[model samples]
Target: MSISRRNFAIGLSALTLTACNSTLGTTSNSGAPKPKGLPADLRPHLNRDYAAWVASFRNRALSQGITESTLNAAFRDTGYLPGVIKRDRNQTEFTRTLEDYLSIAASDERISKGRAAFTRHRSTLEKLEQSYGVDAEIICAIWGLESYYGDRKGDIPVISATSTLAFDGRRGSFYEKQLIAALKILQNGDITPSRMTGSWAGAMGHTQFIPTSYQSFAVDYTGDGRRDIWSDDPSDALASTAAYLKRSGWTRGTKWGRELAAGETASRVLQPQAGGPRFAVTGNFNAIKRYNNSDSYAIGVGHLSDRIAGAGPLRTPFPPDKYGLTKDDRIALQSRLTSNGYDTGGADGVLGPKSRAAIADYQRSLGLDPSGDPSQQLLQTLS
Candidate 1:
């Protein structure tokens, strides 16, 4: 059997407590010992520290030419949100497999909705295509995928998330630059502070755009003089996404590849899989990849966009060797392999090559097939 088709695809609180008993204070001994507790090194960093980091960030933003009013307006009283950190660190939902991902991301319902949106906004999409040289479906698919056609723009404050990342020091420089860019967006008046809420990772707007992307690729598609991706009006966000694709070399007329009906003989040719998926890809496919570097993501977007435009499911199946297992069996087998110390990155039930290798190693240890194909029998033995 083979698989295919498509695939498709925060809270913070602060408390200040002050002991204010005049009589008790006078009665207490002057040399009362401080309470014994673990040192600051053992404790997590405090939100107050985040406030100080933000204070320093003011200077950094000014250095980047963001006005003080915008800096104060956006950054004032903002603190490190622990929920944001939790969300960013645990990005992938634990149970989401590649197949499951495609099921939701490239579902028939979404494609149908997207096609309707393309039709409803045909004039806007056509103008965008003419101006940006990017296809309407590509833009609409990205919009639908990123935020469900703008129904769910994120709610996390950009300043808070980016500031936390900047202070966390793991990728401080990268996040600090993003924080500065966010402030600049505020200074430019593209969106009000109240309306500028976004993802826990600070990607704002209908398209989940980072601050730099908003600055560089966003457009005033409605001619309202503001490149407002955060607004209820999706014209700007949709157009911005198209602009990005165009600038990234989107072919005006090329399709983003289709699933190939490769024969069994093609399975023997694994050497050519280095660049991308085995399916025949086009320029538009690579352009989508530039938005998100993952090949799986690009494939999902491309396939979903095609489907949205009335194309049906993939003409060919993704060979079993690709995942080493079908969707139904992947989760249980992946769980067994992961329990045995093979970290397949996740147990999302999609058997990518790593999961296959893990299955093979487990089988070899158990004196069974080493061909790396997962089966119910193998899963049973592992369990």
Candidate 2:
């Protein structure tokens, strides 16, 4: 089984951080409701209604064996976060092309950092792979992607962020449950609430495990009697990620997947975009997907791992997107569209919503399907 929708931090972190965003809603792709629930009209976090909800939730936490000390410590400075709600609501609705995604996910800088991390942690990482059957380079790749080799674990307070999301009533149920799991972690003394900082969506520590996922997969690799993922040491976090992949059915010593040549074929070839680069994935690729369901994310991790392990870039060129516009072509097309009274945002060479709208409007003028799909024919026609 693959990692659930809630565990896709790799995909979620790529948003542009626009102020006005739409919430992912209380339900995710699996149609499961996220955890939440406070009075309907209470929007700002840490208000009276939110406080009341927290009080009520405390009872539930106690029922789950979270201690009083843990609750107090967690809720002491915990308050509602409107900023988190903005991020939750403002997530990009569309997926990026695999090439676009990997530009950041496995960029030159990230790859370099991944190699450094691999070198620095080789001893511990090799032992982890030996114990868990998950590749050490793959672990470094995840660590690099999640926290930039532990340089950028987020600083948002986990209790406040998760509680705010829970009380906000959008993905409230999911956040609520994560908040509870967080409390359990605190109760177990694995990490203090003060140090339980992470992303707005509750993904924490160097490996960016969501709270519930942390509970399920985190281990005390340092043998310190606690699973401390928030500390400076990334051993526990990396080990936990390896453990996650191991349990998700990672195949020992197998490559995650290989990028295909122009005319190559494999039994499980996955070509996400028709003209883009293709891959012949293995069960290990599927195992990577168990960490994040998106093909781009799995491919990013797999490719980055390979790169860190001294592999080269993709062998084949990924033709143009379905748009039939290469990145440079898209920039030129956008310039043409603007001259033709169809304003795409800024000719950034990426087809975002504004670009699509412009394409759609242009298509409408041409008496076409108005599907907003760019093609060579459309580019030629515009020319």
Candidate 2 lDDT, 2-53, residue by residue in tens: 4362454332565211212122223322343433332222222437887889
Highest-lDDT candidate: 2
lDDT scores in order: 0.65, 0.77
Least well predicted 10-residue stretch by lDDT in candidate 1 = 13-22
lDDT of 1 by residue, 162-224 (tens): 888888887688678778878878777788765676665667787777787777888888888
Every model's Cα RMSD, please?
12.4, 7.7
Once superposed on the true structure, which residue ranges of model 2 sit more than 4 Å away at CA? Answer: 1-5, 8-11, 15-46, 321-383
Give the candidate number with the greatest TM-score: 2
TM-score of each: 0.69, 0.77
Return the lDDT, model 1, position 86.
60
